[model samples]
Target: MKNTSALFIIDDVIANQLLELDDEYIGYQVLHEESFYKHLLDVQEFPVIDEYSNKESHKALLVIRSWQEVREILKEVQKEKNINAWKRLFPCQLYADGAYGEDTIIQNLSCAERLLIRAVQEQKYVMFYC
Candidate 1:
């Protein structure tokens, strides 16, 4: 099996909650626009790492609407860095609004988590964006 980690650009409150929920299983790291940009420039590459088996590692990116621009930026990074395999995961619903509808943010998170788990089990490198 391949090991995996997650990078989040979300607010501290949500990031902290996610960390608490899966501290042992999922590796968590914070990602900010400035820092991420700096890293990308410094490394002259996208923020990616090799996990188990020295193969492509699963990477998940969590960001809010304010930072949604990163989505397109990452696509460029992927192309420049030659990342052929990656999955983009995102929140199916908006959590900021009081849309206490059936499609809750938690449900989306759970579903994404499940998909990630499966991808890891299958030794696939996935890039989840939310």
Candidate 2:
């Protein structure tokens, strides 16, 4: 899982279960290795992250204790100002190798926003696997 991150949005019950059991389980794959954290940092509303541990396995999990916190974070992510900040951070550019370019980062941000909106609407909690 080097240089990659995954976001899982699960039902509150499932989140509680995982927390209680101190284990990890697969859930709705919202973002997989999209590297949205940089963009989140640019927006200056990065969610607090905590470590989720089970035996030798450990992953960074977004510290969201309530749906209201999710909504608050979502609001910051959806703001035009924040979106523009991402745009400035990832200005469009071309690469001769045609690998993942600046546009990919922006696209990832947009996709994350959509999924997080859905999570808010569905009242789910998020866990970041890093």
Instruction: Say which candidate scores most in TM-score.
Output: 2
User: lDDT per model, in order?
Assistant: 0.33, 0.40
Task: Summarize candidate 2's per-residue lDDT along 21-89 as a digit string, tens digits.
Answer: 443443323223243222222111111111112211333433334556667666556434565543322
**For model 2, the run of ten residues with the poorest summed lDDT:** 42-51
How badly does each model clash, as a count of residue pairs?
Answer: 3, 0
Q: Over all chains combined, what TM-score does candidate 1 have?
A: 0.23
Best by lDDT: 2
Off by over 4 Å in 2: 1-11, 20-66, 78-80, 83-103
